[model samples]
Target: MATDDSVHPEARGLEVVIRTAPMPADANGNGDIFGGWILSHMDIAAGVLAAKRAQGRVATVAIDAMTFLKPVYIGDLLSIYGEVVGVGRTSIKVRLETWVERQRRRDGSLTARQSMRVTEGTFVMVAIDEEGRPRVVPEA
Candidate 1:
């Protein structure tokens, strides 16, 4: 999985599910963006896709094969991209990838930036009924 994640560049053509930058409060003791923050965004991205596919409410069932490939900094512009990789009776498996564009210098300019993948994960989202029970995933 590391090889697959490392070989790919920024996810182009795939849907840009969420795009935002980290703040100082989002950083960890090491000065890097906290892993949980990235994981939450990935879940949100996957949920967006999953809900659309299910055409209704959905819940996160599991997060599989989560990988942190690189560190995200406070100023980096984070982009979370998602793709629906699989669908079942009530579950949708989404592949989520996060990339960060870092400012090249202290000038805080976007003109010169570096983009790299920092995290990738597969989130399993399940279509749910109003009662919170698993429901059939509708056909697209």
Candidate 2:
């Protein structure tokens, strides 16, 4: 698994693909956002990029090298960043990173406003036709 340290600050400015706040229902028993919930968001973000690259529908075929560096709170604003790292005849590999901008405290304190990287993974998506058959990725 790739660690957060593998991500550099300069390269972290990739376009944000998905940004949303997690609800209490998405939290685990420990009051932190569930890992599966984060994975779902990552898939959605990666799919968005994949579809754009494939210029059509795409489906996730695999998730590789996922690493969770920190826990996400329910109130945190989750931001997923993705980019097409590789492309094949019918497959697109997207590198995705999840970050969180924690919500303010009840006391209205202005502290802890910095965003933190929580998780990251590479998603392999394949272009598909209407009948769900693999299609060739168009040349860019």
lDDT of model 2 at residue 58?
98
lDDT of 1 by residue, 1-140 (tens): 34354444443456888999899899887777889999988998999999999999999999988999888887888998878989999999998888887874444445666667889899999999999999999888
- lDDT for each candidate structure: 0.84, 0.85
Model 1 misplaced stretches (Cα beyond 4 Å): 2-12, 105-111
The count of residue-pair clashes in candidate 1 stands at: 0
RMSD of each: 2.9, 2.9
The positional error of residue 8 in candidate 2, measured at the CA in angstroms, is 8.3
For candidate 2, lDDT tens digit of each residue in 1-140?
Answer: 35344564237567789889998899877777889999998999999999999999999999977989888886788888878989999999999878777766534466757677889899999999999999999999
Judge candidate 1 at residue 110 and give its lDDT.
54
